[model samples]
Target: MSTKEMFLTKLKRVIRTGFFNFWRNGTVSLASVLVMMVTLSVIGLISFSGAILDTSLVELKNKIDINVTFVPGAAEADILNIKQRLESLPEVFLVTYATREETLAAFKERHANDPSILAALDELGENPLGAVLNIKARDPSQYASVAEFLESGNTLSSGGITIIDRINYFQNKTAIDKLSALINAADRLGFALTVFLAVISMIIAFNTIRLTIYIAKDEISVMRLVGASTAYIQGPFVVVGVIYGVVAGVLTLLLFLPITYWLSKVTENFLIGFNIFSYYLHNFLEIAFTIILSGVLIGALSSILAIRKYLKV
Candidate 1:
């Protein structure tokens, strides 16, 4: 036979042997597959959850901004002009202007049960609340600049604006900084745990596969004695590994999709602007490659180790 034909023939024979072995040792193969599926499923879930959390944290950080509360009796025109100027800043992503009346209405709706506060507000006659400008910055760290700009007392017309008394920026700074740090720490911890577990799983799977092949050492020797080539002998185990990988990949995907979907629904508002399903679907190729490559490596390594230790005899 030509070299190509010979290789093809060997490949066919290897596949045939692999399927036969799988059928003959159905219980063991099934057990290995189950273990792999569970292991890979966990890995996939951790990776997906970490990515989701990271994205959410980033969005939250971006939402963090300085709140500029106007002085009561500040001119409506001046407030609008200030808002326009703030919007002109390259660092500003968005500006929301809330009138004093709107602020009071919101507060009343939120605390409708507080009769005393409502009565006190009524006693004051005119609304004592200030128009508040909610300013979101392009960068969280640029909040200081925005605050300074508002409190600079440089651009206001005479008596057109009273300087901002309190920005509420400092109030939120500590909490936002702590949250960002926590998110980063969680991401690192998750990654470390995943890697540690994956290495452990690989070792266990590799040794188990090697032991399984070792149990058939005499058969391998007999085949070699009967003129079997290395390709013919090793091909079946590689096929078995490929089968294991494919099954593990499918099972992991099946288990993860439903759980992720339910989680997305449970935190729909919290995960706003994020699509869990789309994320998984987009990274499916990478996941597939990892699973397949892991299986192949485990299978080949186990086969080589088994042949070295047992087939040599």
Candidate 2:
């Protein structure tokens, strides 16, 4: 046979032998797969953590809207015009108008059980609350621009009188700045934790695979005695390891579906409808790719490590 043909034959033989060993050692293969599944699960949790963190930050930022309270007796038409103008700004995402009546009603409802506050409201006998505009920006960084636009142009009526009593932008400025820093720090921490957990899990998983490989030492020694090349000897075990990873990666993905569903229900009730299961579904493809690739690499690498030590023949 030509050299190319010889190489092809050996490659085919190695693959066949690898598949055969993997199937024949069913119990060992299953154990290796289970170990890998645990590792993949640890890595998969990174996705969940990221989704939860992002959702919480978004909810917080949404709650951080700028409040523009109009002076008492300010005309509703002017307030609505300001709302329209704020909406026109490119940086603004949403501008909601709350009339003085609605604001008073909401306040009264909140203090309904508090007799002292309710009596105080009754004494006023008049709605002192002003109509307000709540403004949200497309991003936290754009909040400054939105606030600046509102202060610069929208505070005064066309009659040149101050219609806006106060803007609560300064009240929330510090929190918004901290939130931006929190987002960056959270992203870095998430990445670092993922890497840390992945490395630790890989170490544990491969050790389990290595132990399984140790049991097949006699088989490896015999193949060496028959003058098998190192690649030929290692190839089958490598394939076996790859199979373990593939199986585990698939199992881990399946496992997360039900787990996230249960967690989603719990969080919805306790955490104001933050659905982790939805996040899982949305990012399933990216998550699957990462887990499966990690499994395959870990399995293949561990198998090679085993071969190096046990293929001492």
Candidate 3:
């Protein structure tokens, strides 16, 4: 037979043998599949959760912005000019100007029930707040340059305008930096856990498959005695591994979808601008391929090791 035909014939035989073997050892095969499914499910859960957490942190960071309060006498024209200048900066992504009246109105609206504060504000006869420029930076570190620009009374705040009286750089900067650091640390820790769990799952699946093969040692030896070539002897085990892999992969996908959907709902605002379902659906093929590949590799390696050690082949 030509090489291609021979390979095709061997592949057919492998499939036939694998099905027969599974039927003969139905209970063990089912148990092996169940174990593999559960293991892969755990792996998928860990991966999905880690992704959600990372995305949430990024969304949180993007929501944070720096507030620059202008002096009481700063001109509206000057403030508008500063807004334009800040917007032109490479680091600044967005700049919003809020008038003093708007600021006080927002504060009162937020704290409407505080009668004491309202009475005190009324006694003052005028709003104590100032026009504030809200700045969002493309890069977190770029806030320092934005702060310098505001504080130095440069072009934007120049012409005796003193648009920015004080910049609350330390408060906003510290909060953003601390949040970023915490998120980074949490992500690293999650990654480590994922890796560790993956290894453990791989080992467990491998051993389970190996144990299954051990129980079939006599039959494998009988096939070898019947003048079967090594290829013929090993073919069915490899085919069985492939079957396990495909089943485990499908199970993992099924378990991941609903769980991700539920989590997305629970963390709606926290994970704004992110769609977990869309992401998984888009990457489903890649994730499925990885899952199947891992299962097959573990199954094949375990089968080979078991047959070699127990069958003394």
Q: Please give the distance, in angstroms, between residue 51's alpha carbon in candidate 1 and its true position after superposition.
A: 3.3
* Per-candidate total of colliding backbone pairs: 0, 1, 0
CA shift of 174, model 3, Å: 1.5
> 85-138, model 3: which lDDT tens digit per residue?
889899999988899889999988988999999999999998888899889999
Which portions of model 2 show Cα errors greater than 4 Å? 73-81, 157-161, 176-191, 310-313
Candidate 2 TM-score to native: 0.84
Q: How do the residues 69-134 of candidate 1 rate in per-residue lDDT, one tens digit apiece? A: 877877888888888999999988899999898988998898899999989988989888888899
What TM-score goes with each of the models? 0.83, 0.84, 0.88
- Identify the superior model by lDDT, candidate 2 or candidate 3: 2
Say which prediction, candidate 1 or candidate 3, comes out ahead on lDDT. Answer: 3
Per-residue C-alpha lDDT of model 2 across residues 137-203, encoded as one tens digit per residue: 8887788888788778656787889898888988879877788689868877987988798789889
Candidate 3 segments exceeding 4 Å error: 2-4, 153-163, 261-264, 269-279
Full candidate order by TM-score, most accurate first: 3, 2, 1
Model 1: runs farther than 4 Å from truth? 139-144, 151-162, 226-229, 257-293, 311-313
- Report every candidate's CA lDDT: 0.77, 0.86, 0.78
